[model samples]
Each structure stands twice: as C-alpha cells, then as structure tokens.
Target: MDGMQGAAGTVRSGEVIKPAIAFESVHLDLGGREVLRDVSFSLPSGSFGCVIGPSGSGKTTVLRLAGGFLQAKNGSVCVGGVPRSGPSRDVAVVFQDYGRALLPWRDSYGNVSLALEAAGVPRSERKDRIERLLTTVGLGKHLHKYPSEMSGGMQQRLQIARCLAQEPRILLMDEPFGALDAMTRQTLQDELLRLVSDSGMTVLFVTHDLEEALYLGDVVVALAANPGRVDRVVTVPLPSPRSQLATREHSEFLRLRRELFGLMQDGHG
Candidate 1:
C-alpha cells in the first residue's frame, strides 16, 4: 500500500478519507461454481483501479458486483461507505461489446439522450447535456450517425458518452478497450484517463493486459483463478496524465510490467 497512500484517499493535513469503493472479503458463486473467494480491495475517492488476471479469474464478476448487477454470496460490496443492495444511478458501466451495448437504430445523439431521459432531466436540459457528453468523448460531429454507421471506436465512444450522461461517481469498465485496434485502444485509454481525472470519478477497470493495468491504474489488483481471489496489489507510481510512450518507457513501468507478467504466468501454471 506504499503508493496507495496518496491515490486511495484524500490526505488533508494527515487523515485519509474513506475509500469510494470497498470489497470486504467478498465471495461469489455463479451457476453452482465458485467464482470469487474472499476477495477484498479498496479504491479511494477519484482513484483509478485496475484488475488483471487470467481468463475466468472473476474480473468481470468483480465489476458486476461493484455495479450491483450481481450479488456476493458472502461478504459485502460497499460504495460511499454503504453496502450496495442494488444498482445505483451514481455508478455507470461500459462493456467490451459496444455493438450490443448501443442501439443500432439510434443515432449517437439519441443514444446519449436516452440516459438523460431516463434520469428525468427535462427536455430543455437534455440537449445541452447530451451534446456536451458526446463532445467530451470526441463524438461531436458524429451525433447524427447511427451505431452501425460508425466505426468500432466511435461506437465505443458513444457508449461512454451515454454512461457519462449518468453523471456517475464510479465507472466500472470490463475490458472496454479489448476489442479495439491498438492505436484506437491507446487513444481511448488516454481519453478515459482524462475524463476520469476531470470528472473526479473513481474507476474499477478489468483487463487481461498487464501493461494496460499498469499504465492506467493508480493501483493494480491481480487476481488468481481457481476460486478467484486477490493474489497481490501493486501500487503504480507512474505520474498522472500518463503518456502512451514516455510512461511505458519509464523504468518503474517496465519493472512493474515484468512483476505483473510473472505473477500472471505463475497463476496460470
């Protein structure tokens, strides 16, 4: 928890604020099979946390539990110091498959507007909010285009724009960039970091890529499968506003990448 001191909580004079998300010895069973066991971690308010592990390590399940889409068989998942009983508007999720997440018939503007409508925002207020959200995700000019008409990256950006419309306090992403090409993935990664930083929203992102986890996370939590559980937590000391090139080239980044790679390899073997 060395590097976690500053990122996990607000330190004023000397006290640490409560974490924005907390998993307390959480356990889960899915389809009669044990998925997560005794998993625990905490993300401080406005910090970015990444979960990386081999396939079937319950990475997505962790995100689902955090979002209240699934319940833990034992233990608790808490947000803002309260045990989550169900999904709250304060939390939003972005999935890997943008094609399915978005409506093929709706244009980017309509898609983002749906969230505002659901949130009960008035018609007069919805336009500006939707426009701003879409622009924030770099979809300003693509407003009238349908999901089917846009590229994979644009669709994903639209999905994120819709989520941002929720004004969420926590963003849960499940391998959101896994489907994009390398160039597009890196661009979206930087965009996501900027949006999260500016909005002061906490994020819990799950990915199979070790380097990605290190690049975007303030803390990287590695889970081991076969009754998935927290294996280790590494504090990423990389400076904020990380660059795709310079940050990856940093000695600490390389060091942590190697460390995490070994951890994952060992878990698999």
Candidate 2:
C-alpha cells in the first residue's frame, strides 16, 4: 500500500466517535441486476471521502444511498448514527448536471432561496441568508444572473449555494465537477475544499478519476464493477490543506496514483 490503509473505525482513543455517514453490509439489486454487494464504509464527521471506480461500479448508487434517494435491500445506510428512512434536511446533494440542477427561470438568489423556503426559513431573513450562501460559493456578484447568463462554473456554484442553504450535516456529491473544463474543475475543487473546511460538513463524493479522488479525499474508496464492491480503501497521509501543485508533486501522491492505477489494471474495475 502506498498510503495508510484502513476503514473508518467506530472508536477513537477509547471514545465512541459516531460517523457522519455509515454503510454496513449494504447490498442492492436494480431490475434484477445486482448493483452493489456487501458494501461498507464510514466517513468521520467533517471528513472528505471519495468513491472511485469504472463505469457501472455503482459509485453514484453509493452516494444516492446516503442521500436516501435509493434504498439498499440489505444492511443499512445510516446518517448521524440513525438509519436513513427517507430524504432529510440533514443531508444535501449536489448533482453533476449543474445545468439541469439549477432553475433556468430563477436567478441565483431565487435558486438558492428555494432551499431556505423548503426548510421553512422566514421570508424576512431570506435575503441576507441567500446572499451569504451565494457569497460563500463565490456567486455574490452574480446574484441576479440566470443560469443561461452564467458560465458552467457559475451555474455549479449556484447549485452548491442552494444545497448549503439547507445547513446539511452531510453533503453527497455525484461527479459534480466532471463536466467542467480542466482549469474550472481545479478551481471549483479548491473552493469546495474551503467551503467544507469552514462548514465542517462531511462529504461523500463519487468520481471516476483516480487522481481527483486522491487529491480531494481523506479516504479514497475504490470499487469493483459488475456488482460493485469495495476493492481498496486508502487513507491519505498527505498533509491537510493540500496544494494543487506541491501535493501532486509529492512522492506519496505519485505512489498512491500508481498503486490505484495498478488496482484498476488488476481487473478490479
């Protein structure tokens, strides 16, 4: 193993630390097709966990289980130590299709206001709260801009702003930056790290890119396709507040990349 290898345990130093998200012996079948089998993992509060694998590996399925959009036939999907019954305000999801996710008829403010409104935020305080959420995702100046008026990156930011309005404890992201240009994706990745750090929101991000998984995740969970199952779990040892340049250049990063690449080559995906 190139990096620290382990699953997130339930206890830390004799103290029970409940994970923000936990999947235990999870199995699922869609249309008589086994999508996932005996899948399990945990994400500590405020930690970034990335799930990576080939197409049809059920990466998004795993995140959806956490979001309560899809249910597992066996085992449990728990959030904040409680079994997920259905969608809750405590979990917010950011989809990869930013264009479809945002409202074309709504401006940035209105788009973000939808969440607060759904959460029953008061009409009197909506403006300030919306402004703050927009500002956090770097959309402060584009408050009046519609989805068509903004670039892809801006549209994604607006979507993120809306999700943040729910004040979620856990964030589920499904390849959120996969469609953006290289520079835009990198920029958004950094912004996401900053936002999560400030909010202390646990994240379960699904991606196909191995390098992206390593750079952004505290734990990179690789899956094997055709009934997706956990293949490897690598706990990153790179220092926190990772640098796009220096971190990638570090020997450990390169080593982990090769290791994961080798895992993919071994028919795990």
lDDT of 2 by residue, 1-269 (tens): 42333332323422367788989999999999999999998888889999999887899999889999888889999998889888999899999999999989999999999998998989999999999889899988999999999999999999999999999999999999999999999999999999999999999999988899999999999998887899988998988798899999989999999999976665542
How does residue 93 of candidate 1 score in lDDT?
Answer: 92
The clash numbers for all candidates, in the given order, read: 1, 0
Q: lDDT tens string, model 1, 118-167?
A: 89999999888888888899988888999989999999999999999999
| Residue 41's lDDT in candidate 1 | 93
For each candidate, what TM-score against the reference?
A: 0.93, 0.92
Q: Name the regions of candidate 1 deviating beyond 4 angstroms.
A: 1-16
**What range of 10 consecutive residues in model 1 has the weakest lDDT sum?**
7-16
Specify the poorest-scoring 10-residue window by lDDT in model 2.
2-11
How far is each candidate from the true structure, as Cα RMSD in Å?
5.6, 6.3
Error (Å) of candidate 2 at residue 1 is: 46
